[model samples]
Target chain A: MKRIFASAHVKRLFSALAALAILELMTGPPGSALTPTAGFTGSFGEASSFFGIFRTQRWVVFLFLALAMYAIWSAWLMWGTQVRAATAKAVSVPRAASRTRPVRWGMAVAVLAVALLLPHLITDPFWQAAMVEQIAVYVLLALGLNVVVGFAGLLDLGFVAFYAIGAYTTAWVTGALPTAAPFGIHFNNFYAIPIAIALAMGSGIILGAPTLRLRGDYLAIVTLGFGEIITIFANNLYGITGGSQGTNTIPHFSLHVGPIKYLWGLTPVPYYYLTIVFVILFIAGFKLLEHSRVGRAWTAIREDEVAAESVGINPLKYKVMAFAIGASTAGFAGVVTASQSNTIFPSSFTLQFSINILVLVIFGGMGSITGVVLGAIVIQTGSMYLLHTPPAGYQPQDLYIYLGALLVVMMIFRPAGLVPSRRRHREIGLAEKGEGHMNEVLTGDTP
Target chain B: MSDKIFDVDHVTLRFGGVVSLNDVTLHQERGEILAVIGPNGAGKTSLFNSLTGVYQPQEGTITFQGSDAKPMSVIGKKPHRVSAAGVARTFQASRMFSALTAFENIKIGAESHRGIGVAGAMLRGPKTRRDERTSDARTVELLDFVGLRAKANVISSSLSYGDRRRLEIARGLATGPQVLLLDEPAAGTNPSEKLELTTLIRKVRDEMGVSILLIEHDMKLVMSLAERLYVLNFGSVIAQGTPEEIRANEKVIEAYLGSTATETGDRS
Candidate 1:
């Protein structure tokens, strides 16, 4: 291969390859996937599951998939003609040359480049494991919510219902039955994961069924109610779920790659790796889905429901799919939660968890996977690290200080998020322009 | 001159004791400029609203281009669907998407025809990407046609009053409808703009091969632009003929000018 990336002409290079090289040696074997060999008994299973495959031989498989995805994405981008060519042409030299958008190519490139290097410096196994797991959970939630909010233009305040469903599914299937003590299952958590996903998707469709007729506040309230219903069931159903007391003593995740064994035996490392792998796969799946006929139909409805329906797009059909696909995230999260902690609880899947995911979606900039990932880390980590890091005797009132400040700053300085949707920002910015544009620029009714 | 595009057979719209449309019968032919002219409170816009499916008539069979156009069954259908059925309408007020630029607003209406949906805009895949590009290109062409290419990026709200009207027309045209309904193209236009708009309306009809149905109270503009005129009085068609016939009609003169017309070209 030419390896043109080595040339100086490649101005802003991602150090992902370089970081992989050094970590490759530290991880013990070449050609091994980033799947770390960590197990239960208080080790970092999630973390290893996430980065382990990258460090070991299995990385090549993941990399190949990613390369294929990128190639497909690029070819489409290169070949597809723009509908906005009129707008582009309409934008004459003077306006096109305007020096707005202070943060463009250079800054964007720097952010991406730093993302490449930042992974290497993050060597704290505990923190790495936490980061990996956290990223996986949030990204997964964001994907599901994106289908509902971003594609369907439907706001779901109680999205945690699906998450709880997945968790309960995993717990019930992998552990014992309602009749059995402590709820023991014949199948393991790994096997339960797929079933949980299916259950979550089914639950998503069930929720979507009635709610499809509603809009705005009505929809939000219904989703919220659904979330409450799921949590309440978990707390009250002691026979199966252990009630509010919850279930404990769960199993660790285990996987085999070719000749090597990467067992996430109750370690945070494997759990983290597991979460990352799933999150990436989901993102790639969504990337494809977003472009598919179904995805566009969702967005079309999202933008303008009446407009979409006029074009023979039945909004209900696509709306259900969005709900189903989005809820699938919770299923994955459920398996991870059950396997890592060897326990399950209703308290874990609450309205707060739902809101946390929603915040990540908005803060990250909806419709952008990169934005979702970044939002997940920044907002979730900020809450986990900063707000949660209470001073010795920090009371409820005292805790408000940091949160209050963060809220104020977030509202005033960055209403759109750390990285706003480029299209959204531009639309809002340009909407405010024009001295006599209404009269001379374009044609419409005189009024 | 030809068969009516819309044949409203005795539409009797009653509201308790008051009858809004009292046994009204009207016709709008294909590929011709049909102007509905009347004073305020004469149900000029109401008739239009009824035709566009915003307000369903109580009793009427309005057959449009071979099918019943105005029926309560249209109540289930949405505004966009109505627009898609070869009928595009512009609001009397500016109802453009304020968030979108003037160019974008028009493009949206234009793209609404085939590829402006979420699926079309997202994923940047082959079909959607291609559709979007074509839609955008057509939007530019439409903008240019309407002489609003210069203010394409200006938000719909930020545009001057005249430009807003132009934008609305551009947007309506973007729907690619066979029928274009203008509520009042010359309502707020100055003499120069009015003259230009008159020319534009004619060009739109002649060049685009679409039917134009206008509602204008401007007698002079109506006289010059309308090949056929329907004079409305209190939700009823009192006179229907050419400008020359309408001028000579006793009922039209009495309804509009409160006097009987003695000649075909009588003024004042």
Candidate 2:
């Protein structure tokens, strides 16, 4: 009770009441007057009447404003002190390696359980399917983009080109479009997956071969052009791609082994399971790649290209390989998405989709597989949730405004992201330490 | 091994109109320490860059005598290719992969020589696993040699100045090169650290049979450690001889030492 009545809480409560009173006055009395309630007569009469009105409602408004200002000022002071204390504690604590095998295994098991139970827990077919198609696809895309941007330190803004190529490959191979099919060939979606992945990787090499030499912004521009080119091609190639109409009647994923046969239908639960399996496989593969020799080379190149070359690392070869590997994941995702929807459209492969995937990767923490996954789930599911059950006066488009604000705040406060990779965390921490050292030097204090 | 390990024949490198190296010629005999000493901007680093394929000389040929009999022309080759052909180099500013661990940095060098392909790395096949194991063992051995075994797992950026230089040398050695180029390896190091570096350089040459071509400004370190010396001035070789002869040469003293001929003065 004493703590509740402390200065801070009391001040906050008082400000709340004061704000309510001001809102009531601004809204006016219960019934609409339809005109000015206080009538002014002559100069002296008007002055006296205005003063009378000010003595009541206007004075309450002044008190409300003062209380609100005090509340905000006190809150700001508390926040400032708390931030300083947290920063001091963070700097003093030695970084402890927390990636013990048992802990990792526990996380893996927990994730697996969640993935297995998710379809059953969400009985709503529409949401279940939406979760699989929208969230899962972005998760896969984010993971792929993570390899390019986070692991290899290549800022690829046109990652969706690979995704589009994968979907188109599936559409062509599965004979989805009557006019666009090659020799009217029809194949299982499962069979088309490998072909789609191969084609995507090939395209990756072709695009990366010439442009991998371009660094930073130049590379990003070239990739953006590549993505635009692919979309333009899809839109224009009427004979092969069905152009604006897009390929439809694409076959769904099916399996026919000796004794059992299964076909994925309108219900998204089966597709969800299939995508979950691939996600697990990819996570394992990406984790393995992260710890391997290739991963070391990527780290070396990312840190310093000239140093990497002096040590005999062929930067071009490794960079192209990263592109191809990253593309392969998007290709797989594309195949899953095309099959799930039973269609592939050039309109579907927009630059916004690429940016959305990149946003998830950034939000989750680059170079972290689990971070990307969680980021995808949170952002995608959260946005969809808002769209379905928005508050009064809220629209689905408002999600972008919220996301933009969140990104700005994240960049300022936690640039390494929510679940940063160990290396990234250390890099950011060391950079901050350098800033602190500079401050000490400027102040003539010993570090 | 043959007597001649690296042969730089009349190499001339120019960027626009400024001649960084003007018809400069030098050589390193097998298993010997050769030092190139010059005043600042006197084309010492230009020569190192030429040999390492960072810059291709407009004229003359740079040759490396590998295990094979033929000397490979390395003038126009890529940097990685040059490194692959039995020559490795350390940077003047200690160019380490700052984000990677010291062990991992050395391992990258060793793996570059071992030649594990993308598929092999992804699959972790038997051959790749064996190669990785061998490289890891070699990395540990090199770290021990450079006296950085305690900081093997520490990030390269966090290493002390002296240790970072030593780590660069270890990374160079991990490439299993026939000739190792050290560019101001003793820069920023204290006297005791410099002594340790000198001893380590001698050990690398005598025990490992790796020829060293060093570019340094520290006159005392160069005079004490180098068996032979080449002095440069204004992008041209002014004197080349035994360290004792070069030290006594009047032209070298006038042009390079500049009347502050006290050999014990700190040059770095």
Candidate 3:
């Protein structure tokens, strides 16, 4: 019996069973928020709405549906390898090699053109706001977190803390908060940019200096604690931070140069353009750093610290640098967000926000610039769409359930993510073959 | 000014109740091949770790004399600092950045000596570009020197065992070290590969003019390659001399071959 249970097929079946249980638990009974009504009536009825259609959730029917989906997924898992192999053999030239430089350049130009025109093309003011709020801002957050989690192989759970710091710094600088600004003089929102970035980077270094010596899990726990501490401070420090009420009169960005004066107002289009410019600048800068000596050092340290040290690469220095660099991006993002909304709330920066950005990084492809950008766009758009036209029986709380399901599916199918960095793709491929170091995938133990 | 590359004096490293290296003293002459051979738990690796600044000895001092500089102390410095001070080493088990290609692996070592900071890398200014070009050229040169130039694009993990060992040597040399410590470079290689490795080691010492300190259990390789040998047992050096002199010594034979008596069974 033990031998039978130990068989690979049996183990796979057990995993499928586990997945079914979790999915069932997450999905629950398809109804409105549960009430203690005895009768099958109103919101408590078994017949609940889905996509504007009232559907009955009989046990037998739901089970059959879940089982059918599981069966198809299993079939794909079993047959996908052969299909992929057959197609690979049929295609003589590699996919990447087939796309010549000029073609790639043309594609890039087209993408930029679309991005530049997107805000103007969308007539709805709501979507224009969403594009900047839900998508662009999150993309910046994800890109910053990617440097820590994706590039440096650090699981930083306190990433949103930096964002909070940036926002609060902006608030303080603009005299929105009760605390006096530096030199006892209030500054415009634009002047807060450099101060916020410097403070965020300084905080990152301070947090990282001693704690980065801790390996994997301990480091993660430390970062998690840091995140909690920041939130608590923001909530309790009522005199300085405005506490849970948050800072409400943070001013919008303004420019005052010789013969040129402009003030950004409530219109989201101009803010979108400004954000696009910063995002482009950051992407270009990060792309350059990714292929340079610093990037190589991070990769080396991530791969093997001892070996990196032997080769004269100081591990702690690079790790701290990663943290500071990552934090600066988040800091700038905080500035953008605080100024755009003209109000700051401690509730907006939460542990959940950090995890959400991490999800974006993982879903997009951790270390791939293009991947994370696309991931943010797709996920934010989907979530916004859901909010705009929520299905019957849907609640704001149920969004995580769908996101969890999507992540699980992604992990099972494309473990490296939607558009994995080339090295990451190769590593995952090797792990599948049981050749490369697989602990990162299986045990969450980084080398 | 002695021409000794590494000067160790009565170093002791202890972990709790156990002593890994007990009052170990050794020295390596400039531009010479030295070997330390020992059985399991003989503290050869501990001595190497101490020398490379991975472990701090509880007692004594280790001084390193570069080609033309003052004899600087190596006892308290960190590994990278020691490496920057012209000391580089490899592990008993190869620890290549498995995901990186051979060229990239070498380039990392080559670029480590000097380069621009994060801001410069992000900026991609002339200095950063020039540094990158120099490292690239150095990587190619080292690849050719180790005769892995053709396989430069191959991932380090995907290379054959012998090729990986060669790649590691190439990587160590890329650091521009005055002294290279190799830990069991011939462990997993076949006889022909071992012969190639021996030639490569000699080439490294002769052409690059780098001093070598090797740790190996392979007696033939050690005897053929090293000018002098140190035999260690129970965290202490039992014998040290020219291989010819050490080979014929009773203490050395007893330590390595054990006492030729049946009564001393466990010791043997």
Candidate 4:
């Protein structure tokens, strides 16, 4: 119809096709025999030969294939946008009234059932252990990072330092290090869990106590430095940390209670279950903390620190608590990762890992537990899946480009995220409504 | 001295070389509504800051009636510590947590004074639960008192300007202070809202039995609401007397009221 031709979609399609044609013309053919040296001669024969090659059946087929791919991509984009807009309209209905208790309970039960049966249902060892379970570690990391960035409104750029601390603590305790243990004693990974968490929390306090006074960008820079310092120490400290090679062959999680005796092996299913249990516990605890006085205080501080202080909420104490609590989760994740792999390297604790976890939190919707968990699952699992079985003609490394594009698109369209918390949604709505700017003007917070 | 709840003895607060409050001294009698009226740059806010420990005075001492009946020196303490010592204040600009519900804002003020620790909050033990329940009840009560019970669940930012001022008062009352300092409470309010605020200030003094130290530019409200007035011009008190006496003082009129007489010209 005439409408379709006049539509913005058609314009986009034409532009995309035009770009592809330009690309085809410039590249000539894939791995063509014509070399760059043939260009310097300015020979008419060579130029005509190149044009002749472009006119061939193979070149024509390649151009047509590119065109078809662009058409499919454009169609997919249009469909995705339409579906999202429809869902957004639907979500405007009051959420609590729509979902009755029974429906909510049923959803919870279904999710639990799925989580419980996941490893068993996916009997493929590679997918279950290597892909799904590995992604779960990142999920835990994302959830913890959410506490710091999402709940406390602290931009902690060095969260992975806690992860490194946790991993290194496990290595030290389980006697995985080539160097002698401090007390020459080895403990089970099960025992190392608590120890690692404690150590990580202790380090969190140490880092937070001094640096928490520095807010926003300053805090982020300090945390960044802390993370780098941790990585550097892990890389250089041979006697205590085993240096760049890192620690390996850590003891597995085992218990020796009165009648019950169990030792986890290289099987990923048990580790997966272990992680899920902790995740559930953290989610529950976080939910409680979210509604408690501490949570209210955090929210108040996040909104306005001076107001919070006037009401007697010490910004430092709550911020430090957030840091320690967030760090504990990262420590928990590190312990799980180390036990699962029976090794951890300094190289694994990179700034890129921190950024990846932050992306998961942002992608899911900060401050929403479900959002963070789902975000971690979707992004981490999707990336791992892509790496394991990349699409034809696409390299595994191309995942970053896709991720970058996804982030850009998400920021442009849905900045509140995939599953924003009620508070976050309200905040975003207020900002969009220009209330935030009005507030800044009224309060003389012009900067 | 025994009846005085807050005594500022020659307090001089300076920011670098610029003197904000130069040797200012005043005292509030227990359960009395007192007002400090002055021009725009008259150091009224600086005095409030000194009293609240936001800025420690360079000279002299601020004395508050402690639990032992003896007046204790409260100079140089932190702002939160000052609140803990039973001196609550509301800012000139309404500073309620804009994102929080009105109830939550009041609850924070109550909880801060209630002494619930992080461990107690997390554990939610019987004691913590009891504290929380009581605090919630108190928050509801304060909301009712402020006539904002209907808007308790509404976010503070969404409330009208008058409602935000009332919520700020409710939050301040939640701190359970012996004396409350209100900075420019009538600022930006319409005549009806100003009347409501004046009645609330009186009710706070008479019913709640909390001494009020108010800073105001509205001379009519100050003259009507305050039992006694402290007239300040250039950070020094020119006169301290009953409204009748302050109204007749030539020095007070020449220094302050002469310039802003048109605004307060209706006073007979």
Fnat of each prediction?
Answer: 0.07, 0.69, 0.69, 0.46
- List the per-model TM-score of the A chain: 0.65, 0.78, 0.86, 0.81
Superposition error at A8 for model 3 (Å): 10
Order the candidate numbers by lDDT, best to worst. 3, 2, 4, 1
Give all TM-scores, in the order shown. Answer: 0.68, 0.86, 0.91, 0.86
A27 Cα displacement, candidate 4 (Å): 16
Instruction: Tell me the lDDT of model 2 at B128.
Output: 80
Off by over 4 Å in 3: A1-79, A89-94, A97-99, A429-447, B259-268
Per-model lDDT: 0.66, 0.82, 0.84, 0.80
lDDT (tens digit, per residue) of candidate 1 on B1-268? 5756667777766668776777778877878899888778787777766766656778867656722444223333555556767677776764555545776666556655463343333345678767767878988999999899888888566676677778888878887777788888787878788888888889899999778899986677888899998888888889899988887777887787564245323341
Residues A253-304, model 3: lDDT tens digits: 8888998988886688888888898888888888888899989888888777
Tell me the deviation in Å of residue B18 in model 3.
Answer: 0.8
Q: Which of the numbered candidates is closest to the native, going by highest DockQ?
A: 3
**DockQ of candidate 2 compared with the true complex:** 0.52
lDDT of 2 by residue, A233-264 (tens): 99998887889889778889888999889899
The TM-score, computed over Cα atoms with residue i paired to residue i, of candidate 2 is: 0.86
* lDDT tens digits by residue: candidate 3, B130-196: 9999999999999999999999999888998899999998888999999999999998989899999
Give the clashing pairs for model 4.
none
Candidate 4, residue A437: how far the Cα is off, in Å:
9.3
Task: List the DockQ of the predictions in order.
Answer: 0.12, 0.52, 0.66, 0.48
